[model samples]
Target chain A: MLSKKQARAFFLGGTVVTFLIFIGLTIFSLSKGQDQTNHEGITEQVVRGKVLWEENNCMGCHTILGEGAYYAPELTKVLDRRGEGYVKAVLMSPVPWNPNGRQMVAYGFTKEEADDLIAFFDWIGGIDLNGFDTVVSPLAKDKIERQTKN
Target chain B: MKYKSQKVAYWFFAFSMLLLVLQITYGFIMGFARIGFDGLHEFIPFNTARAVHTNLLVVWLLSGFMGAAYYIIPEEAQRELVSVKWAYVQLISLAVVGVAAVIGYHFNWWEGRKFLEIPRQLDYLVVVNVLLFLGLILATLFKGKRKTTTALVLTMGLLFAALLYLPGMLPFDSQVTDSFFRWWVVHLWVEGVWELIMGGILSFLLIKLTGVDREVIEKWLYVIVGLTFLSGILGTGHHYYYIGVNNIWLIVGGIFSALEPLAFLAMALFAVNMYRKGEKKHPNKIALFWTLGSAIVSFVGAGLLGFAHTLPQTNLYTHGTLVTAMHGHLAFWGAYAMIVLAIISYALPNMTGRKLYDSSVGRAAFWMANVGMIGMTVAFGVAGVAQVYLERKFKMDFMEVQAEISIHFVVLILCATLFTVGIIMYIMDFIKHGKPTDEELDLESDL
Candidate 1:
C-alpha cells in the first residue's frame, strides 16, 4: 500500500480539481451562450399567454422550458411539433381530443385564449435551449410583469 | 444518555417522527389524487401536496441529523453539551418554522421551485434555526476533552450543508442560474458533504457495535471523506447536463458522477470489513442490523442505481422521468433515512434505560420497510423504463403514455402502505422506550 502522505496528496489534488471544475462551469452557464440574448420581441398577446400558462399551472401537467411535470408533452417545442392550429384545437377541448388519455383537466379556453397559449408556445419555441439548460435571461426582468399588466 | 443535555435529542427525534407522519399522510393524499381521487384537488392540489411532502422530508431529515449530532457529539467528545435550555428552544423553533412552511405551501405562498419552495420569507427562519444548531454542535465539539475524527467530520458536514443553502437564496433572475445554484444545495448535500456525515455516524456505530478499534474505524472515515469530495463536488455537473447549462457538464458530469459510487462502495466495504475484524461482539443486534443495512443498501441504491442514470446517454432519456423518482426514493431511504434510524435505534434504549431490541415488531419494522422500499423502487423503475421508451423513444403521445403507466402508481401505493406500517411500528417502539432518565446515564461512555 502507499504511504499516508501519498494518500493525502491524491485526495487533495482530486478535491481541488473537482471543485474548480464545478465553479468554472457554473460561471460558464450564467455568463456565456446565445441564450443571453434579450427577450425583446415578445408581443402583448404572447406575454398574456405566459401569464395564462402560469396561472393555469400548465406546468402541473405539461413541461414548459423543460421544468414542469412529465405527465403531458413538453410544450416548449409544441408549436413546432404540433403546429399552432392543432395546439389551439387541443387546448380548445383537450379532454375530447384525448378521450382516454392522461388528464389535462379541461380548462376550456376560447379560441382567442387558445391562440394566446399558441403565441406563448411560439415565444418559448423560438428560444434556443439546445435540448437542455433552458436559460431564461435575467435581462427580461419586466417581461412577465409587462405580459400580466397587458 | 451519557450527557444529561443529550436527552433533548429525544424530543427532536420525537418531533421528527411527527413530521414524518404528516409527510406520509400527504404522500397518500397525492397517491390517491394520481388515481383520479382528486377530492382534495381544490384544497390541496397535486403541486401543493408535492411541495409539502418533499419539504417535510427535508425538515425531518435535518431534525434527525441534529438529533444524531446531539447524541453522538457529547459522547465522542467526552463532555456534556454546553447548553440544554437553548437546545430545547432551538428544537421548538425548528418545529414551528417547519410547520409554518408546510401550512404556507397549502395557501400557495411558495416560490414554486421544486425543493426550495419554503417561501423565501421562511428561509430566513431556517437559516437562523440551523445556525443555532451549528452553534451548539460546534461549541460542544471544540470545548470537549477530545475532538475525535468522527465528531469533526460529522460537524464539518453539518456546517457545509448550512453554507450551501445560501446560493439557493440568492436573487437570480434567470431560471437556469437559479437551477444551477439549486443543485449546489441538493446534489452537493446528498452526494457531497452528506456522505461525510454518514461516514462519521457509521464509524461511530461500527466502533460501538462491532467492538472495533477506534483508530481502524476513523481511518476509514478519512478515506470516505476524500472519496466523497473527490467525486461529489464535480458530480453537481450531472444535474447541470440538460438544465440549460454549458455543454462541458455533459462530459465533466458523466465522468465525475460515475465515480461517486466508489465512495459508497468504500462505505459498504468498510462496514463489512470492520464487522469481520472485530472479535468481540456488541449485544445491540437491531442497531447493528440497521447500521450494516444502511451501509450495504446505500451502495445498491445510491451507488449502483445512481450510476445507472449518471451517464449522459441514459440520463438524456431518464432525466425528469420516473427513473429520477425511482433513484430518489431509494437513495434517500437507503443512505440518510436508514442511518438516522440506525442511530435512533441505538440511542433510544440507551437514552431511556429500556431494552426492547429483542422484540418481534422491531425485526418486522426493519424487514418490512426495506422490502417495501425496494419494491417501490422496482415499480418506479419499471414505470420509468416504460415511460422513457413510450414517450421518448417511440414518439407516443404523452397523455397516452401516462395512462399506460398508471398501473405502477397502484403498486407504488401498495408498497408505500407497507413502508408506512413499518415506520408506524418503529415509532410505537420509540414510544415504548419512554423518556430518558439519569439512571441510564451510567450505561455507556466513549472515552
Candidate 2:
C-alpha cells in the first residue's frame, strides 16, 4: 500500500522532472543551430504581413500552419496555391469575397496592406513543414513539378 | 454550509449559468453557419463566433472553478473566506473583463491568436483579476485551522494556471515560437494544472458523498494528479509536432500522449471504487450521477477519443480538420463542464437550504444532456472521419468536401437543441432553489 507521503512525493517529484525536461527540449528546438523555424528570414515586410494577419484575425476563418477555426481554407501554402495577383484582388476587393458561396469579410485593404500579407504568405510558404506541406496543399506538388521541369 | 462566506459561491454559479447560455448561443451560430444558414455573417462572422465560443468556455469554466474553490476551501480549511467583499469585487471584475473581451471580438479589437484572443491591453486586467482571486483563496486557506491536501491541490492548480497564462502573453516574432509557448498556457492548463483542480474537487465530493475515509480519498487524489502531470507535461509535445518544431516532438508526443489515457482510467476507477466502497449514500443523486458520469465519460471522451487522433501518423491527416473538433467537444464537456455542473448540483441544495435532491427534472436534465452530447459527438465524428477521407486523403477541394458533409451540421444542430433543453431545465431547477441563505449556515453537520 502506497502511503500518502509517497503519493505526494510522486506527484511533486514527477512534476519537477518532466517540467525540467520540457524546458530543456524547448531550448534545444529553438536554438539557432537546430532551428528549422526560419527565424532570420523574417524581414520587415514579413513582419508587417504578420501584423496584418493578426490585425484582421485571418486565423479566425483561415488556418495558417494548420491551426485555426477550420471554417475557411488552410493558408499555410496560400502563395503556392493561389498566385499573388488573385490573393491581392481578394484582399483589395471592396465587397465580401464569396467563393463557392462561403463569405469572407471584406476589408478592402490598400495595395500596401495586400502586399504585406502576400509577403507574409510567401514567407510562410517557404518554411519546411516536415512533409505536412506535401500533404496539405496539393498545389505544392504542382509547384515542385514545375520547378523540376524548369 | 459550514461558513457564511460559502453563500458567495451561489452568485458565481449563477454567473456561470448565464455565460454558459451565451456560449451555447454562439455555438449554434457556428453550427448554422456551417450548414449555410449564416445569416449573421455580417454581424457575427464565423471567426468572431469562434473566438466568442472558445473564450466564453474558458471564462465559464474558470468561473465554475473559482466558485468551486470558494465553496470547497472554507469547508476544507475550517474557516470562512478571508474577505467576502474582495471576493465579490473579483467576481464583478471578471465579468467586466469577460464582457469587454467578447464585445471587443465583435469589433475586430482582438489579438486573433485562436483561444488567447483577448488583446494585449486586456491581458493585464485579467492578471489583476486572477491575482485578486488567488489572494483571497490563499489567504483563507493559510488563515484556517486546517490546510487539507484537497485545499492545497486546488489552490496549487489555480496558482499554476495563473502563472501559465503569462507564457501565452509573451511576444514572439516567429509564429512557431508564439504557438509553442501558447501551448504552455492552453495545453498545460487543460492537461496539467486543471486536472489538479479537478482531482481536488473530486476528492472533496467523494469524501462528502461516499462517506469514504478522507485519508483514503485524498491519497488517491494525489496519485491521480501525480499521474496527470507525469504524462501530461511531456504530452505537450503532441502539439509541438508538425508546428515547425524539431522531429523529437513526434516521438516524444506520440509515446506520452498514448500514456495520457492511463490517468483518466485511474480517475474513473477511483471514482467508481469509492462509490462501491461507500457505506453511506448522501441523497444528492443528481450530483453523484454527474460525478460518476464525469469520470466515465472523460475516460471515453478525453482519454480514448483523444487517443483516436493524437498519433503522429493519424494527426498528419486530421490535424486541422473537423476531427480535432470532434475530440475537443467531448473532452471539454466530460472533463471540465460536467465537473462544474456537479459541484453546482451538489452545492446548490446545501447553500439554499432547499433539499430538492432527486427531482425528475434534474434526472431528465442529466439524461438529455448526456444523450444529446453523445449524439452530437457521433455527428461530429462521422463528419470528421468523412472530412479526413475526402479532403486530406482523396485531395478534394475544401469547399467541395464541406458541401459533402454539411448534413452532419444539421444533425449537430438537432442534437444541440436537445442538449440546450437539458441545460434550460437545470437552470430552472437552479432558479427554484433561489439564493443562498445565511440561515442555512451551521444548520447541519457534514454529510
Flag clash pairs in model 1: A132-B244, A133-B243, A133-B244, A133-B245, A134-B244
Instruction: Report the CAPRI category for model 2.
Output: medium
Model 2 agreement with the true structure over B16-117: per-residue lDDT tens digits: 999999999999999999999899999999999999999999999999999999999999889889999999999999999999999999999999897999
Chain B of candidate 2 achieves a TM-score of 0.99
Instruction: Name the candidate that leads on TM-score.
Output: 2
- Candidate 2 pairs with clashing backbones: none
The global Cα lDDT (0 to 1) of model 1 is 0.79
**Candidate 1 docking DockQ:** 0.21
Q: What's the TM-score of each model vs. the native?
A: 0.88, 0.99
Roughly what TM-score does model 2 have, to 2 decimal places?
0.99
Scored by Cα lDDT, where does model 2 land?
0.92
Predicted candidate 1 versus true structure: per-residue lDDT over A1-150, tens digit per residue: 654445446656877887887777677666645353235546777767765664455555456555655555666566545567777777888453444623445557898888887877776666555454222221132344455699
Model 1 chain B poorest 10 in a row by lDDT:
B171-180
